[model samples]
Target chain A: MIELFSDLFSDYTLRTVAMGAALLGITAGSLGGFALLRRQSLLGDAISHAALPGIALAFLITGSKAPLVLMTGAALAGWLGAALISSVTNRTRIKYDSALGIMLSVFFGFGLVLLTYIQRNPDANQAGLESFLFGQAAALVERDVFVILGIGALVIFLMGLFWKEFKVLSFDPDFFQTLGFPVRALDHLLTGLFVIAIVIGLQTVGVVLMSAMIIAPGAAARQWTDRLGRMIMLSGCIGAVSGVGGALISSSIPGLPTGPTIVLIVSSIVVFSLLFAPNRGIVFRKYREWKSGKQLRVEAVLVDMYTLAAQHLSAEYPHSARVLDVMSSMSGPARRTLGLLKDLGLATQLDAKMWSLTPEGVRRAELIIQRQFGGEE
Target chain B: MEYAIDIRDLTVAYREKPVLWDIDLQVPPGVLLAIVGPNGAGKTTLIKSTLGLVKPAAGSVLIHGKPYADQRVNVAYVPQRGSVDWDFPTNVLDVVTMGLYGKLGWFKQPAKKEKVAALKALAQVGMEDFADRQISQLSGGQQQRVFLARALVQDARVYFMDEPFQGVDATTERAIVDLLRDLRKRGKTVCVVHHDLQTVPEYFDEVMLLNVRRIASGPVGEQFTEENLRATYGGRVAFVSALVSGKK
Candidate 1:
């Protein structure tokens, strides 16, 4: 652990790779919140897959492997794939998802073919190009870090500038239209930013695991908060932590690759949030259910006591506590609740076997009945 | 004076059959109107087409003598509650602030003025106390009021509400009715796609009974008769059954 922290700061290669990975995480994670909210979580998957062809084709056409050139090529190809998906869905009876599947497979398959072609006609330059498939985070120098940083900043700025429009369009495009905003333009802008986010991550995270960077952080963050602003911020934080942690861990361990390691860390965060987040987490929800059930048990005992008192025409008429065991639907000893009720002064034990509601308890039980029958429900 | 809403020869279709067939309608200024019909009668389609949310195959929609696009500022719409995901991670005030997004347009953020307007609108719908509450925590009626509050923030001259009272509690129904009357009093035009025909005479001043075609439209006393209702709802028996069921 000490070595990892020490190396994270001093080792230049590790530092550069960490910065690049963190940039990819923040960009993809924040924008991925919108994509998730827009019900287009899988869009990242399709676009990232389609970017493989763009990366290969850029090298083929330009014969240059500059970060900017390759990234621009990848962004254009990713944008074209997204555009084609829309056109096919709009023009034909084909569904949006099916069109995505078609574009993803076709572009990726073509990219493989191009990659093989380049591989056969190999020069030393072509050797490192194949690393784009899985990504060589260790090979990411300071220059690559700058490129990712520049693109990530641009994407974040665009998101902030058009924050309201992007938010409204994601939530309700029809309502956004009624508000006199250009729905299509905002949509294209968001999708364009989405493509940029995918492209910037291609070198460090690679196309295969880039979609995970986009989706996992946002999804995990969603479990943490009920506000979009908070969700986006939290997602960015998770992504940063995952990126830095993944880079350090992958560096310290000899065989573990950085891209997949980052993916694993992000995925673990998602699993953790899914189980442990306070509001939406599975564990919290189960805890809430269990807590509510306990409350219901106490309420049932109180109400059952009230029913008996009412039947006897006296609030103080002590009845057999064993009768509550028969009256209550919840599977627990009715006597177990007396301690709680006694603490609240809502019930009193007249004897070892008998109990009755205090005046307050009777009032509370009546209110509960009224709520069940007549109130806001 | 120009009619608040003027739709002419509007037609919308899914596939073979048109949902709305050459429909022509108009609403005068300062009236509470209810668009009533049986299920599958293009009630929602009418509102969508008018708001330019849905494309009409053949027709034109006008707001205050201008095309809808030109007059969107003076128009507010509340779509069906079921149309959006309630579990969406937003507080009540944020959703209400969306109503003012029209004024902000693009690139500008909603500030103190917008927040105050949203809060006032929430008060109008009796949801002021719930302004900070998450949308997912709301009851069905509270959700309906939030949607109403959103529309109210628009503060438009013409309002289009598509079944705002669906699945709401009696309090919300009363609140919505009082709100519609208040809108009418202020000379703001309000049209609601309503399901409960029993409340037609008590709630709406003007009624538009529609099927695939325009059956009748006018004051409730004249156009809301059994004869027109029968034609709009496919004969007397179905209409009676629909009324007995209380919701269509």
Candidate 2:
């Protein structure tokens, strides 16, 4: 690990690839947060897919494989895809998802045809043009890293600038407009930023998996916090970690592509969050449900003992454990539930088959019964 | 005297279907008005068009004496609570602070002053203790109150509320009524898109009965009558008061 760390700093190509990938992660992760919250995850998919045709068209038109030139093309086409989706949904009765599907497939299909055309042409300059599909992150030069840095900074800056407006717009656009905001223009600005974020990632993560980078980081971060600012910041951190981790793992391996490796890392993060993150995690929620269910059963057993003791001559009289099984709703064995109550100091095990409510447990049972029946009045 | 809200020759349409037709209204300052009507009565559409949220096919809206754009800050709005996602990742205080976005304009963050104002507004709605609570954790009535608190921080002369009492508990309903009366007492005009016809006369001094077009609009005692209600709701309402009053 120490040797790898030193090599990461000393090796120029590995360093460039890591920086470029990290920049993509940070940009896509933060902006993807807005997309996720707005329930516009499909927009990212459509935009990235639409970027493919733009890349091929940019190469065909300019004949130069300059990163900036191609990225500009991708940005424009991606923006056009989002705009077309919005307009189609507005102008027709077709649902927004269907419009997104139409634009995404159409642009991507055209892009594939153009890519095939470029490959068939007898031009040696088109050597690495195919890498835009699955992104050759290993081939990212220092210039590409610099471009990602500059553009990523600007994207982050713009997201910070419009933080308040975009948040309100996502929450409630009608109210946003009523506040005298130009809702349409601001919405376009945010969407334009999404296009830029996608364009920046298209060269490194590639079109096929760029949308995953845009979506998964934010989704993973969402489970950890309840505030948007924290969610975005956490998402950026997750993005950076996944980017560096993917770069390291792919560099160590013989033939692993950085794009898919990074996607797998981010996917692992999402899966981990879904299963184990506090409060919102599936495992945590199930554990809480089980714990509460157990507590309820324990309390049920204690209360049944108290009720039976109330009917008898002496408060110290023990109730048979079988009586608890008859009165309680849950299917927990009476002895086990009584054992839990004893652990909680709510009941005393008088014998092998009988139990009695303790003073504290008696007080609690009366309070519960009072709340249950008296409150209804 | 200038009206607080003045609408003239207003028409709103979606495609070929007219939602509100060539309507005219003049609401004076310092009165709590209820725009009462059945579902699809264009009540929300009227408010949206007046606020420039939706385009009006024809006509003009004047806030105080000028157009809506010039006098934007003088207007406050509380959209339907159901219209927003309560599960959104924000705290009550943050949502309330969004009201100051109009005054702060573009690119400026909400400062300490904005937080103070938001907290004060929350106190006004009796939600000061829930400032840090996640919005998703809020009950329906608490969500409505938070929205009301947000509008309070807008500090506008005219407040437009869409269904403030819908789905709220009885205590919240009374509290909203009290807030409306307080706004009236402060010389602020409040217009609510109200659905509960039974509470119209008791809660509002001015009432507008609408169905596609204005059926009747004036003081509740004079305009909110059985005849106007039957005309507005089209005789299928089955209201007991209408039957009792009609017999009288």
Candidate 3:
């Protein structure tokens, strides 16, 4: 284990893999941020599945998995699928989701049939092709890593340059169209970049799980922040961590699929963020609400005591030693209420265990009730 | 006088159902015209055809005596408030800046001047304070203001707005009307698709009443009378009168 750690630090191949994974994560995550916000989160799924026929066709035509041919096939198929969905939705009455659903199933089904035929055919010498389904990172060559990094850098640069246009089209497409901007073309460009990211992820993360890499990190980051720049950056960071962490862990464990492992890691990050984020997370928000309710009840009790005692126009109540009198002034869950106030230092135990409101506690309670329910009669 | 928008027998159809038929209208420069109709009266389809968003089946849309393709930059549009996804992750400033993109053309980012114009438009709509705020954080009125700001940055000679006051509050409606009047003063032709029947005279100088067909269109004095209103919306009353007069 120690030797493997040392080797990971020193080996150039391993270093290349880490850098490649990080770049891919950043690219896919950034584009995924917009995709998730556009409520087209399932676009990643459709594109990844659509890329399969492209890969298969490219190899069948060229008889080799040449980088250029593979990318061309992937980009062509991806663009075609995206354009088809859009045109179908606009021209026909068929809904967008239904169109996307049909495209995904048909394209993926065709790709599966083609791939099976290729695997059984005697003329096809494609080795390690099945790995695209469930990625085998051990088979990723140095050239593959370089391709991922190049596509990643290009996507990031394009995103920066057309940031304003993309923002306009996604938010107010009608306004964008009104300004004579080609909103349709901009949409195609965004979807194209997303397809490229999915293609790069396919080599190692595989089609089955690459979709999660494209969506989960962005979805998780969305839970934490609303700002676009921050959300994209945070999503990139989360994707990078999941990618690199999954790669490292899978490399350590024998016979484990890297694609599923990475998806698991990405989903775990999403789960962690959804539950524990400060403002929007489920658990923390519930906790804050619960704590506030408890505090409000205590304040309500003190206010009741304060108002009751104020009738006497004195600092202390003569019959303050009676627990039943304090309890009688309040409503709803009295047993739970008295115990909470006593526990909160708002009241003190007197002789025979009777309770009296503390001065600090009395001041806090008086302010709350006065502001909330001030002499409404 | 340059006619900003000139339509010659404009006919548009959707799936063999004619939405607009043999419509002829000419909008002169520096005029603020409002198109009023009931629900599904093809008001949107008219503006869309003029903007080249929808293809006309048989007529021509000429901008400055030319096709819209030649004068695309001279025309700007503001669609209905609910037509867009508000939850998108873009700020108001970014949206407004896109108005300059038509002038800048492709592959070029908006310059500092464009940004300044966008900011100026935002100020005009009292939305300068929220220039950097995400569009989702805005109210319906604020959202309409941002879109108006975007169209203002377009700096077009002709403006087409489709139901711009649909979901806006009274204050926003007034602000938008004032903005349109200001645009008219600046010699820009503004065409608005309006729905309110009560505020037609106060808000618009000219009115075009439609009911999937041209009912009456001219100055308010000549075209917007009870006769015109009955033609546009009083089908049953017209039928009863025809029967009583022994004409039907």
Against the native chain B, each candidate's TM-score is 0.95, 0.97, 0.92
Return the DockQ of model 3. 0.38
Tens digits of lDDT, candidate 3, A1-377: 67766767897766666666777788888888888877788878888887888888998898988665777787778667877888899899999999999888888888888888889888646876777787766666788888888888898899888876776666666666766777778888888888888788787787778888889999999888867789989999988888876776666676777789888989999999999987779999899999888776666667666766777876345234344445655545544666777787777656554556778767776678778878785
DockQ of each: 0.78, 0.84, 0.38
lDDT of 2: 0.89
Candidate 2: residue B199 Cα off by (Å)? 1.0
By summed lDDT, the worst window of 10 consecutive residues in model 3 chain A runs over A315-324
Writing each residue's lDDT as its tens digit, candidate 2 over B80-157 gives 999988878999999999999999999999999999999999998989999999999999999999999999999999
Ordering by TM-score: 2, 1, 3
lDDT of 3 by residue, B1-248 (tens): 66888888888999899999888888888888889877777999999888777888988889888888788888888888788877665688977887787777766877888889999999999999998897878999999998899889888899999888888898999899899889989999889999776667777777898888888887765676766777777663444334223311
Residues B170-191, candidate 1, lDDT per residue (tens digit)? 9989999999999999999999
Better of 1 and 3 by lDDT: 1
lDDT of 1 by residue, A1-377 (tens): 88877877898888887888888889988999889898887888889889988888888888899999899889988999999999998888999989999999999888889889999994777776777776667778888889999889999999998888888888878888898887898899899999999888887777778888889999999999999999998888888889778877776676566779888899999999999999799999999999898789888888888888887869767888789887874658888887789998999988888888999998999988898778765
True contacts kept of each: 0.89, 0.87, 0.52
Kindly report which residue stretches of model 2 are placed more than 4 angstroms away from their true locations once superposed.
A1-3, A251-254, A330-335, A348-353, A370-377, B240-248
